[model samples]
Target chain A: AQSVTQLDSHVSVSEGTPVLLRCNYSSSYSPSLFWYVQHPNKGLQLLLKYTSAATLVKGINGFEAEFKKSETSFHLTKPSAHMSDAAEYFCVVSDRNGNEKLTFGTGTRLTIIP
Target chain B: GAGVSQTPSNKVTEKGKYVELRCDPISGHTALYWYRQSLGQGPEFLIYFQGTGAADDSGLPNDRFFAVRPEGSVSTLKIQRTERGDSAVYLCASSLMVGGRDEQFFGPGTRLTVL
Candidate 1:
């Protein structure tokens, strides 16, 4: 079985400060990991994905995540947080063996304070 | 539409009633998926279809749920004898192919409320 665990249920950060959302995964095979952000009343938008080619993957709106095998972690980070970045984020994992079913983490609600 | 589309953004139904939710995948997309999300939770996989066949349905919670894609372009999720526990945001996504590396494009989702 494959699953993902998002360490924090909620995270708060002041505007312009750095942000981090932690996630970990357990899969029988090498996994494809992705981070997605969903604004209020909006569909989820892809932030980034790690397909095994690169451990450090960059995404839109200045977001990035690193895949670490030893740690079994794929944590998302941003150098600075903006008010618009406040949203719900999901960490998803899928095995490279073509399972095609993505297992999603519980989710992390991000709040940016002005 | 250029992206995955779902109908009836909001639905309210009474317990014991039947409900049907629809999804339209992107043009030429052969892989379609359905997921359910409750409040404060991430989307949970329910079922997946490749072309006209259901490739995987292991994630469906119970037999009360059923889905179909007759033509491989549009799909519908059907619920029988719905209960309050069935209330959730039903999300639909589609990808160009069925693979681990392919990205799934999501729809806005249908929020279902059971009373």
Candidate 2:
């Protein structure tokens, strides 16, 4: 079984400040990790994914995440926050093989205060 | 190129009514999936299809939930005897191929509210 846990349900950050969203995961196999962002009334958008390649993965919109095997975590970060960055972010996990089902975390809602 | 599209952006039904949600995947994508998101929670996997056959459906809550992809391009999620607990957003996603290596694009989702 594979699962993801997003540490913060809601994260508030000021514009121009660095943003951090913590996530931990558990998987029986070589896990594939992904971060998806959902704007209000919009579809889920793929930010980044880690498939056992480089520990550091870069995504769209200036977002990035590091895959730390030792910590069983894949935390998302941004160098600076923007008003458009405010969205519900979900950390997802899946088996790297044929199990195409994506197990998602409860999600972290990012709120940017201008 | 178009992204995934789902119809009936919002649905309201009484208890025990049957409902069907449609999804039109991106053109030429071979893999399709269904998921459900409840209030204050993440999207939960429901089923997936590779071509016209179901690839996995272990996430389905019960017999009340069923899905089908008739021609391998469009899919539908059918729910029978709906309950208030079934109220949630039904999402459809599709990928280019049949493996986890591909990225899945999601649809805007159909919000189902069971009354």
lDDT of 1 by residue, A42-113 (tens): 998889998878899999999999999999999999999999999999999988643378889999999999
In the range B24-91, model 2's lDDT, one tens digit per residue, is: 99999999999999999999999999999998899899999999998999999999999999999999
Tens-digit lDDT track of model 1 for B1-115: 5988999999999999999999999999899999999998899999999899999999899999999999999999999999999999999999888864678889999999999
User: lDDT per model, in order?
Assistant: 0.93, 0.94
Candidate 1 chain A — worst ten consecutive residues by lDDT sum?
Answer: A94-103
Best by DockQ: 2
Model 2 chain A worst lDDT window (10 residues): A93-102
Per-model DockQ against the true two-chain complex: 0.63, 0.71
- For model 2 the TM-score comes to 0.98
Deviation (Å) of B71 in candidate 1? 0.3
* Regions of candidate 1 where Cα sits further than 4 Å from its true position: A97-99
